[model samples]
Each structure stands twice: as C-alpha cells, then as structure tokens.
Target: MIAQRDLARAISAVENGHGSFAQAAATLPETARTAPAYVVGITGPPGAGKSTVVDRLIENFRSAGETVAVIAVDPSSPFTGGAVLGDRVRMQRHAGDRGVFIRSMASREAGGGLAPTAQEAVRLVERAGFDVVLVETVGVGQVELEVVSVADTIVVVTVPALGDGVQTIKAGLTEIADVFVVNMADRPGANRTAVDLTHMVRESGRETPVLQTIASEGQGVDALFAALQSARGGATNAARAVRFEVLRAVRDRAARSALAKLDEPAARAIFASLAAHACTRRQATDALFELFFTGG
Candidate 1:
C-alpha cells in the first residue's frame, strides 16, 4: 500500500496541475487502477447537513472496522484560490484517528459541485488502501449531479423546505440520485419531503431509496448505513467509472498542454492584445483552443 503522505502528494500535484499526474499515480500498486466501486458520493445543496451526515457515516464505518478517506470539496477563496473551510470543521475530531483521512479541496470555481481533480484524488485515496472513499461536494444548489461519475453509490441530501415542485423537475439530479436523503428530520415537513422524493423517483420509473435523517443527532443514520451496505452487495458501474476517468485525464492533459502555449511568442501577442482589450476573452480562448487541436 502507498503511504498516505505519498497519496496526499499525488493528489496535490494533480489538483495544482504542477506535476505529472501520471507519474505520481504510478507510485501505487497496479491493482489500484482496476475497476473498483468503493466510492460513495454525499452531496446536496448548502445547509443540507451533508458534512454532518459524512461525519456520522465515518463514525459508523470506522466502528465497523473500515478505514475511511474523505474528500470534502469546499468553495474556493477569492484571493488564494484555496478552500474557504478545511475538513468540514465538524470532522476535525477525527484528525487524530489514524484510520480516518479527511481532506478539503477548493472547488476553484469548477462546475458540477466538485473540484477539477476530485475524481483522481479519490483514486489516490483508494490506492492508499482505504476501505471506503466518501466524496462530499460543495453544496451549490442542483449542479451536483457530476458525483455520479466517481461514486458507486450517489447519495443526494436535501432539506425539508424547498417547495420547488418535484413533479416538474426535469432531466437532472432527481433522475440520477441513487439514494435520496432528507436531512434535518426533526424540522417540520421532513416526512413530507421524503414522501415527495419517493413519489418523484417512482414517477421517474426508478425504485430509488429515500430516507430521512437528523444528522446532527445521529438519528436514522443506521438505516442509511444499512442501505449503503446493501448497495455494496449489488453490481456497480465500475467499468463506467474507469472509462470516464481515462477520458477526463486525457482532456485535462490536453487542456494543460494548450495552456502551456500561452508562453510562446505568438500566444504572447494575443495576450498583449487581450490585456489591451483589443480582443475579447472569447477570442483569446478560441485562439488557444485552436492551437491545441490543430497544432498551429
């Protein structure tokens, strides 16, 4: 097994785009790259109590004798481009626990509620021999459906008061969520939200599981744990995850190579024009992308 410190370095290299993600990743055993479905994505809108749910899940998993790694994607800082908050604050208690590894990654304005390198980071954690990987997204409204690309089981958490008609929801998160969780169940309309989610899933022709929870109080988490375990027993989309992983890696490298052209004299002229507002950002972006695709 790769050391956790080495795994952390590999993820850092990937996230910063500073080094060869391939070289760093190659330090792991070849088995680490196999089709593995040990990831569980916990995501929802802000204030859905996803962090607390993850904390509780970590506790349960550790108690069940599993080593857990967490990647909590947080909003980025305006100046430093780093995580506004690290390790979910609530999860700091586990800092001393050798069996639990938690990291907070800055989303850096990436869409789909995840950091650009979050998928690769999850794989790095897996390479470190963690039994389970929990990916928590930056809860920015409904754009979190991207979690499906990485996790074997995607748990969508929501609160009780969003009155947006579930029936009117379209081809989005509602259709992709493997499990729906209505957190803060002590609040009013908790059961109502659960029922609405159930009905919505049924309407979509899926028998998805919907559960309610008071994550802060650790209520109903046991049932959720059981449900997650049940998912582990079933077939997973490991083959799909592996395909996306390689595709994304290729695209990421291509983009980086294109960006590197900015230092070339020809590209510098474009940048000069861009700085003088002689051309629009769209023009500059198109120029760079053209260089990448056409080798111009």
Candidate 2:
C-alpha cells in the first residue's frame, strides 16, 4: 500500500506533466491493469449534493473493507484556470482515512464535463491497487456522457424538486444512468421525482433503479453501494471506448492545427486566393492541405 504522501505526490506529478507517472502507468503489471478498482461515476446538476453523496459512498465502501480513490472534478476559474470549489472542504471528514485517497481536479477547458486527464488519473489510482475509483464529474448534464467510457457504473444524482419544467430537460441523463439516485430525498416531492424518473427509465426499456437518499445523513447509502457493486460492467465497451478516445485525440489535434492556421498569413493568403477564384470545395481543401502539409 502506498503511503498518503507518496500517492499524493504521484498524482500531482501526473497532473503537472512531470515525473514518472506515465512511465509508472505504462509499466503497470498486467494484473494491476486488470485490478478491481471499480470506477464509479457520480454526476448530476450542480447543488445536487454530489459531494455529499460521494462522502457517504466513501464511508460505505470503507466500511466494507474497500480502499477507495476519488477524483473530484470541479469547475475552473475562467481567469486563473484553477479549481473554483475544491472538494477538500466538503470531504474533510475523510482526511484521516488511510483507506480513502481523494484528489480534486480542475476542469480546465477539457470540455465534456471532465478534465482531459481525469480518466488517466483514474487509471493511475486503479494501478496503485485501490479497490474502487470514484470519479465525481463537473455535472454539466448530457455533456458528461463520456463518463460512461471510464466508469463501470454511473450513478446520476438529482435532488428532489428541480422545479416544474426541469425534469423534461434531464431525459438524456436518465438514459445514461445505471442507477438514478434522487438525493436529498427528505425534501419535498422526492417520491414524485423518483416516480418520474422511474417512468422515464421504464419507457427507455431499461431496468434502471430509481433510489432515494439523503446523502448528508448517510441515508440509503448502503443500498446505493450494493446497487453500484451489482451494476458493474453495465456501461463499458472497452474496445469502443478505446476507439472513441483515439478518435477524439485525433480530432483535437486536427482542431488545434486548424485553429492555428486561422491566424497565419500564409493560410490567409491561400484562403483569399481560393475565394477570389470561386474554387470548389475540393480545390480549396487540396490547397489548404498543401499549404499545411506539402508546404506549397
């Protein structure tokens, strides 16, 4: 078992683009790669008590003799690109638990409601021999669908009474959730919200459970944990997920190249020439390719 300081240092090195984190990850024993660090994604709208839910989950998993690692993604400051609301304040109760490792990450323009490195961090934690890796995302609704790629089970947490019209807006979330938790269930309209979610899940032809909980009080956490354990391998398609990541990386590289060209004088001159000649799409594409690749 890694000591607290060493684990934190390893994760920090990975986040800052230094040290042997990647090397360590690449050299992980085959057994470590397939270890049982069941990654669970807990996501929902802001103020849905996601942090509280995560805290309760840590307690439940620890009680079961499971060591857990958490990568909590918080929105970044637009000005400084630093995490705006770090989880250290919310999850301080676990500060003394050797079984729990918590790391807060800034969602620094990675998009899709996660830090670009979130999945890598999860992999590192898994490779380090944790029993569970919990990824709590920024909870920006449907954009968080990518969490399915990393988490074996996804629990969508929502509070009761999101107002009259918001339920319809969350249909996409309902579809991706393996377990729908209506947190703060002690609040008004808890049953109604649960019933609505149940109907949505039923209509989708899936048997996803809609559970109620008050995470702050640890209510319903044990059942939630059981559901999480039972729901493993529900959303993962390893091959497809790997392909998507590769495609996304290529797309990002292409996008960066195009954006860079937009500010280049040569690209501008080529665009002007193409426009002046009323060039066909293929002709303009060929010219642009030549400008960037063939250096024409």
Candidate 3:
C-alpha cells in the first residue's frame, strides 16, 4: 500500500511539472482508464449549496457500488498561506470509507481559478482505481470555465432565489454547462428558474440538457444521472482528438512565449547588475537602459 505521505508527495511532484511525475502517472493500468469512472465537475456561485449537492452525489454513486475520489479546491488566505477548505468537513462521512479518497487543495494565490496543478491531480486520482472522480472548484467568476476544459462532464449548479441566475447564464458559465442543475429545487421559483434556463439554452442553439434537483434530499438525482450517461455516450474518439489538438497548440504557444521572454541571457545579466547599482544610487533607469542596450 502506498503511504498517505508518499501519495501526497506524488501529487506535489506532478504539480511542479516533473517528468518523473508524468511517468508515475502513466504506469497505472489501462484498466484505470477503461474503468466506468466518470470525471464530473460541480461548479456554481459561492453560496449555491454546491458542497451539499456534491455530498449527496457521492453517496448516490457509492451506494451504486462505485468507488469515488473527490478533489475539492478551496480559496487560499493570502496572509496565512492556509485555506479554509470547509467543504471537505461537510463530506467527512466518507472519510472512513475504504472506497473513498477525498483531497482538499489550497488554491494558493492561483487567482481562484482552476489551478495548473488540478489536471495533474485528476490524473493521479484516475490512476488510483476510483470509479468516479469529482472536482469542485473554489467558485470563481468567468475563469471557472476552465473546469469544463478538463472534465468529462461539467455540472453547473445554481439556485433560484439568488437573483444571480440570469446574470450567470448571460456570462460564459451557461456555455460550458453540459448539465445545468437547478439545485435547491424545494425553494419557490425553482420551476420558473428551470424553465428560464431551458429557454435560454434553446435560444443559445446548444443542445445541452438541463435538470432540476432538490439536492439536499436526493430529489431528481436519477434524472441527473441519466443526463450524465447520455452526455458520456456522445463523447466520441473524434471529438477527443480535436480537443487534444487544441490543447497542444495552446501549450506550444505558451512555451514559445516564455522562451522568448528569456532569450537574451547577457542582457538579463546586465539588467541584474544595473538593478543592484540603481538600488545603491549608482545608476538611473535611462542610464541603465542606454548602457545595457549600447553594450557600454
């Protein structure tokens, strides 16, 4: 059995972009890939009861004889370098379940967006024999759309009374929700919110499916599961290939840009020298620029 500390170290290694980490991630059996696990993303506004919904979802999956892994990203505290990670505590009932592995990640000044490390973490969990992987992000505006980029199915959760539902739909969030869940369906206006969402999605000309759920009591969960299955069935190999090509292109461009910024080693050395000199009142910006550029 891999020790918990070792597992944590492996996750950190992958996060740091080490080649060995990629190799380690790949060694797990192809069975892990073929396993019936689904990578589901649950995201929404800050107070939309997303955590509660996730807790219920995990219970439903586990009861159906599937193992589960959860990666919950929590906002970081700039002053302390620590995170509240309160969502993990709410789902602590699964802590002792042999088939459940739950990990809470500190967003760590990663701008409350999907951390670069999250993809690596998902790879690790997928390889660990879990039949399902659930990722819950630290609710972020706009940039949270990155979740859909990594997940097999993105479930965007929202509530009716918040009055922010329409605005959220107007933003990019509506575009990425493969499954739109009107959580807290027991509240008034839930049906209106659902109808509004259905109409908006139809108007957008996207065929995405929407479902309503009183997630607190497991209401409407079966329909949500059916929608997820339908979406997964449509995930063809051709579509996957296109996504990979796009991601690779983006990565290549980023790499080239980073390399260009550091292309002049001698100029960088001179700038370091000038910076020290300026700190000591030995040079001004204009003088440093002229000397560095003119090689004088």
For candidate 1, the per-residue lDDT at 268 reads 89
Q: Residue-wise lDDT of candidate 1 within 199-280, one digit each (tens)? A: 7777778778999999999998998998898888465545655776678779889878877776888888888989999999
Top of the candidates by TM-score:
2
| Cα lDDT of model 3 by residue, 154-182, tens digit | 88888886564466467777766888899
Worst 10 residues of 3 by lDDT: 278-287
Ranking by lDDT: 1, 2, 3
| Candidate 3: stretches off by over 4 Å | 1-6, 16-20, 23-33, 78-80, 164-169, 236-296
**Can you write out model 2's per-residue Cα lDDT over 104-199, one digit (the tens) per residue?**
888887767777678888877887788899889886665666676687787899888886535634556665677889998999999989988877
Ten-residue region with minimum lDDT total, candidate 1: 28-37
Between the candidate structures 1 and 2, which one is better when assessed by TM-score? Answer: 2
Which whole-number lDDT from 0 to 100 does residue 267 have in model 2? 76
Per-model clash counts, in order, read: 0, 0, 1
Of 1 and 2, the candidate ranking higher by lDDT: 1
TM-score of candidate 3 relative to the true fold? 0.75
